[model samples]
Target chain A: MTVGRKLWAIIIIKIFIIFAILRLFFFPDFLNSKSDTDEGKGDYVREQLINRN
Target chain B: MIDQIDLSMVDWARAQFALTAIYHWLFVPLTLGLSFLVAIMETIYVKTGNPEWKKITKFWMILFGINFAIGVATGIILEFQFGTNWSNYSWFVGDIFGAPLAIEGIMAFFLESTFIAIMFFGWNKVSKGFHLTASWLTAIGASLSALWILVANAWMQSPTGMEFNPDTARNEMVDFWEILFSPMAFNKFLHTISNGYVIGSIFVIGISSWFLLKKRHILMAKRSILVAAIFGLITSIFLVGTGDGSAYTVAQSQPMKLAAMEGLYEGEAGAGLVAFGILNPDKKPGDGEDAFLVKVQIPSLLSILGYRNTEAYVPGVEDIVNGGYKPWFEKIPVEEKEMTYSVAQKIEKGKLAISALRDYKTATRAGDSILAKISQKKLQENFNYFGYGYLNNPESVIPNIPLTFYSFHIMVFLGFYFILLFIVMLFFVNRTTLEKKRWLLWISLWTIPLAYIASQAGWVVAEVGRQPWVIQDLLPTVAAVSMIDTNSIRITFWIFAGLFTALLIAEVMIMVRQIKIGPKEGGSK
Candidate 1:
């Protein structure tokens, strides 16, 4: 375990974590469909209340 | 009309926050304190040319590694919760809240993770100086993480560096520095870090003492206790000071929170602080049935802490609840004419009811006693309604008071106990042999769980006391939720529960493996 090797190991870990985080943020659709359904439901509830009023 | 639905949402969100926050805290204190311990051990090795110091560092690092893994796992869920349970709040305040979180991930997480890996696996690879530098950087990274998280949370409590936007219905940050240096942020960051230092120091001292008592690693144990004691003393004192500052800030900015924390009911000059109390709001404080166990009264303590004067007015629960003090809304002025008309109608209705009852009594005097009794019952019910404001029984608005009360007490009691424990350890280390005191060693071992309990109680108090409010007075918790169906929440909750549980178990397994291995055998030389 040389200094250069250690540095490389750390760098690789960081790259992986960062990449995962970015992918999760960008392609959030693949991870979960609940977010979209959540948004739709919120809008539906608000619209229903408005219509009743 | 929407209150019931809103209340349920608030409760659910609060429960989720409580679970995550408690679990997150279980690891965070150790991270903060353990980082410092590792840095100190490495420093001692570098200075004293002792392989034993290296061994001490390695052992604690193993525990630190376990804590870090769980901390990271729990922390991820917390961030997701902001979106899942509190989606509206995220949308409303993300502009302000998201900044610190982003900085924490970018600046602190990278530094921490990078250095941590090097420190863990780079023993034979890096230069001595480079290795030591990695350890120190990791320590700094942990502190920086605390700083950023506290900044975000403190901003929520006190609201700094932000202005209200009518269009977005949210607060937007105006200045980064303002948010960073806000009084709330400063106090909370210091207080939290200090607690971390205390926890970390106590843990090292406890484990080292255990080894010493067993006659294994006596020399290393002695050094570890000495280092821990020094840190323990400094952090103990710092914790007290920072706690005072935090309380003072809460009194100024979040008076309702301060009142709830103290359980004050009536306004008074130099009010007595409740050390222990069976808080029954249905009865007065000294009613003998539901009274506080008054242990000690430091006169003018609250006033001095809050206002820098002994006579400053601290508003009580009654004032806040019944004084018509709306937090974020303007008071509407009543029209005198409309008010008079309403009052006259109420009075007229009452007079007509009284006359009808009197007539029924007179008419039934010589005939039916049963009819008269029925009329009297109706009259009494109507009168009681006017007097009590409603005939219908309102649903209970009370919080789970007993749980809140004891959780609060447990936290406070631990705070004081830890203060004394640290003090005693410091004294023994400075004067007598800390190793000889078997009783103190055992106590230190037990303080490990005490730290976790205190951390949990703090979370319980914050989330539980806030109750219906997700954003403290501005937004109700239920209104802040994502409009997803109950089934959706249930599904995600289970998924998260499974994932977190697996991560927790994995973390524990790794920690046990490291501890079994003990310190690394080879020396750098």
Candidate 2:
């Protein structure tokens, strides 16, 4: 492959590893994981804010 | 509703985020600035119809590609970190913060990715004018991305156009345009991008100097030096101007950060700017110990830079902590009579705000609209000092003095050095004896790393100097973290450390190999 093609391949691989694999396994979105609805998320945040303080 | 916070967990999460951010920053400035340099070189080639210029452009473009590919999406982890490590901070200001980031994704990312494809592969496939346009668009895309991100960050420093919604428990954008056109945003974007420009110029000239040192591509080296030195000279000067603007903004919005940067403990009119100083390790707030053990200063310079008036009062750490003096400028939405407050008073007000929020929530749940309105009004009155309520000790408001002070001085000193270096380079590049100046060539090559150091130092000053606060007065760093296991964050921190180190090693090796290959002979179309 040309150098540009090889670099592009690396980039694509990297994006997949970062966004697809690592994100799924390691870095779950906290609010989304805890609650699917906006109201639920707001309740969670309020509870955390008031109770934690 | 955990009563006790795992402070260790918060600290570890902070470390992880800092580690990722530091790593991500290593590549971003280069991408931000080098794209434009490459575009400019391509423009010259198109204008002159010179194959030699085309070869130079291609050579630099390949280096730019290597950097862009390796650095791209490294910041993806940083964004994810917001969800994983700082979930509360994400949800709290996400309404205000997420807008710019979303815009950045939709506008800048697509624009950049599209044009970059054409710029890289369309050399002979597309018309020359079209190819040049793609190159310029790619550069603009990178800068536009920076603009949105910087606007978001500037909001953190001097939050504007945002209102606290007790119902959602988040700061929501009330005026998007105000947030976009904030004074801090303007200064930060210009200063940060100019720093990138200076770094890009330094990289070009430094690498070109290496070629000259090895007695290879002498003509190309000279030509690159001529263009880069002039570019570097202009941007470095602009960097100083923007730095001044930043200092002034910090003085107005974050007096404590300014005081920490100067290592000042006593308020004064006509405060001298510390040119160089060593902090007294024994110094503590209100202890009357000398703030600086030894120092040199430019008289009244700090006052002038900060307030644009030589006699304007510049408060120090003690004054900020004790807080009796009236500020020259205040941005917080508070009653005019309540403008001055000690840290202790602010903490009291912040606690009131928190209590009012709790009451508002409870009242809403109990269907008490009248009580809810009363609580909401109280919360707004005290909300400016809301983050202060979380602190147990008033002095906790002070950031790390020594780190902030030293970083500021080092960055300032380097700014002057860069200007001088560019001037010398511009002169020497025109002279016949340029190639013979082996010492100067070595200095030029060494400057590449120094430029990176200066760039990093600027961030340290900005970030560390505002310590303990995630968003100026609204959220404390300790309060902003996710409730996660400390050991998990610790493990991830090391994982990132190793991962980023490996990436850095790979990038350096690839860059050096490409440099060894050098530009193509007789140039490519």
Please write out the lDDT profile of model 2 over residues B192-301, one tens digit for every residue. 99998899889999999999999998888888888888888999999999999999999989999999999999989999999999999989999988888899999999
Query: Scored by Cα lDDT, where does model 2 land?
Result: 0.87
RMSD of 1: 13.5
Off by over 4 Å in 2: B1-3, B330-339, B521-525
Taking the tens digit of each residue's C-alpha lDDT, what string does model 1 give over B377-403?
Answer: 655444311211210111111234445
Q: Number of the top candidate by lDDT?
A: 2
User: For each candidate, what TM-score against the reference?
Assistant: 0.76, 0.97
Cα DockQ of the candidate 1 complex: 0.07
Q: Chain A of candidate 1 scores what in TM-score?
A: 0.41
Q: Quantify all predictions' global Cα lDDT against the true fold.
A: 0.64, 0.87
Model 1 CAPRI rating: incorrect
Task: Give the CA lDDT, 0 to 100, for residue B342 in model 1.
Answer: 24
